[model samples]
Target: MEFDSEEEAYDFYNAYGGRIGFSIQKEYGNKVNGRIISRALVCSKEGVKGTDKQDRRIFSVQAIDVELASDLRVLACNAYELMGRKSSGKESIGYLKVDLKNYLRTRRQKELLYGNAA
Candidate 1:
């Protein structure tokens, strides 16, 4: 559940996302001193393509800190599991959004304790 690098986070999420009927996209925030200051994973429907924000759903990974990336990955996987239990697409996505918010809160707590290590 813990990753030492962003690549590991991506690999784990992408593979799991594929298995659960979604695709993961990496979104980077502004840079600081040539290093990324923030990062997130956007999990959308598999094969859905477009720049339109409405066409896809997004999940923030909270990967700015290497240490917290593992937590974020666990959160994502948990959301995926919650999503898998739903029979309806809309219902599943709704579950994911709610679960993601709770996970984000937990990630913030970890960030406060550990500080960003990027």
Candidate 2:
């Protein structure tokens, strides 16, 4: 689903993750030019290990601008789709592929539009 703010996005996932068999394991703050511009919600199976690592699956939400934020929404939705598919199949690691896709898409788009927005 589309979110109007980063907090809303995070809240939605955090609140529903447990019911869906995963939980928010970590939150990542993203900076751009020394300013906080985005946040990522990391999720894993209820009993998964090493959740506090950089290699976990995540759903990112950005507060860059209207247009860019819309892109971020799309990325988040795509991540949600992957999470649903993988969780349903009981393939925890498979979800990371979707996270990687979103991450790469976010990076490429930010580079092309915001240049150094990382």
How close to the true structure is residue 17 of candidate 1, measured as C-alpha lDDT?
90
TM-score for each of the candidates:
0.34, 0.31
lDDT of 1 at 111: 75
Model 2: per-residue Cα lDDT over 16-116, one tens digit each: 98788777854445444444344556775434445554556544232232235345665555554444443343233323444555666776787889666
Candidate 1 TM-score, true structure as reference? 0.34
Best prediction by TM-score = 1
Off by over 4 Å in 1: 45-118
Error of 1 at 90 (Å): 34
Q: Residue 3: error of model 2 in Å?
A: 3.1
